[model samples]
Target: MIRNEIKIKSEEGELFDKKQIALAIRNSTFEDDLKCSLLEDGILDKCQGCSLKYICNGIDQVVDSYMEKTTEIVNNFNFD
Candidate 1:
């Protein structure tokens, strides 16, 4: 799924492209999947009990997957 067309940009500059991100998402292992699991799944929920949950936007595993390596060029990118 991950081709070689996407453009990856970091704060400094573009780091990767679309295809690369798709590859990473597809190659995710069980543990890797678990790391970003949602609160209902257990991962984020634990954060809720922890002190940092308040600030943590909670892992958006879905978005993590949906966007995976390719982020659509929204109207604005807030890198803050």
Candidate 2:
């Protein structure tokens, strides 16, 4: 995944290395599992009409705009 030196502090005030966190995240299937559960429960269907459907964590207008602009630019490109 992404590499960084960010340290995480636990509730017990103990600091841990970012490598441990990265390893845990890299080995986790939490996002796929959550998406599957939400789809089974019909939660994902509800998000179909939402404007922020592309965003998983939260609403980011900048990313949405960038995606739209990128798509438009790509569509206008002459690949032939």
Candidate 3:
């Protein structure tokens, strides 16, 4: 499954910071319990006030449970 998407509070073409979002993800115990589908669900739970808007921009993709392991976001990209 590919979580190759981004989320944001607005669509004003904001260039958010990835390090901050990464840090939040790392610090979030609940985030650790989240599935690998980072960009698929409502990240507001994880990225509440985050700055990594670009990472989830133009994101309308999804990866259901049937998602494969050799997919894009899970296999190719490493948000960690």
Best by TM-score: 1
lDDT value for model 1 = 0.54
In candidate 3 the C-alpha lDDT for residue 27 amounts to: 38
User: Per-residue lDDT for 1-80 in model 2, tens only?
Assistant: 54354566679775778565444443343332223356567767666665656764432444344446555443555677
Whole-model Cα lDDT of every candidate shown, in order: 0.54, 0.50, 0.42
TM-score of 2: 0.23
* Stretches of candidate 3 exceeding 4 Å from the true structure: 1-13, 30-80
Stretches > 4 Å off in candidate 2: 1-25, 28-36, 57-80
Q: Is candidate 1 or candidate 3 better by lDDT?
A: 1
After superposition of all CA atoms, the RMSD between model 2 and the true structure is 9.1
Whichever of 1 and 2 has more lDDT, that candidate is 1
RMSD of 3: 14.6
Please give each candidate's TM-score.
0.25, 0.23, 0.22
lDDT of 1 by residue, 1-69 (tens): 443645766799966675566555554532355343465676554664666555344334543655555
- Candidate 1 clashes between residue pairs 3 or more apart in a chain or in different chains: 3-19, 6-17, 6-18, 8-16, 39-45
Once superposed on the true structure, which residue ranges of model 1 sit more than 4 Å away at CA? 1-15, 29-80
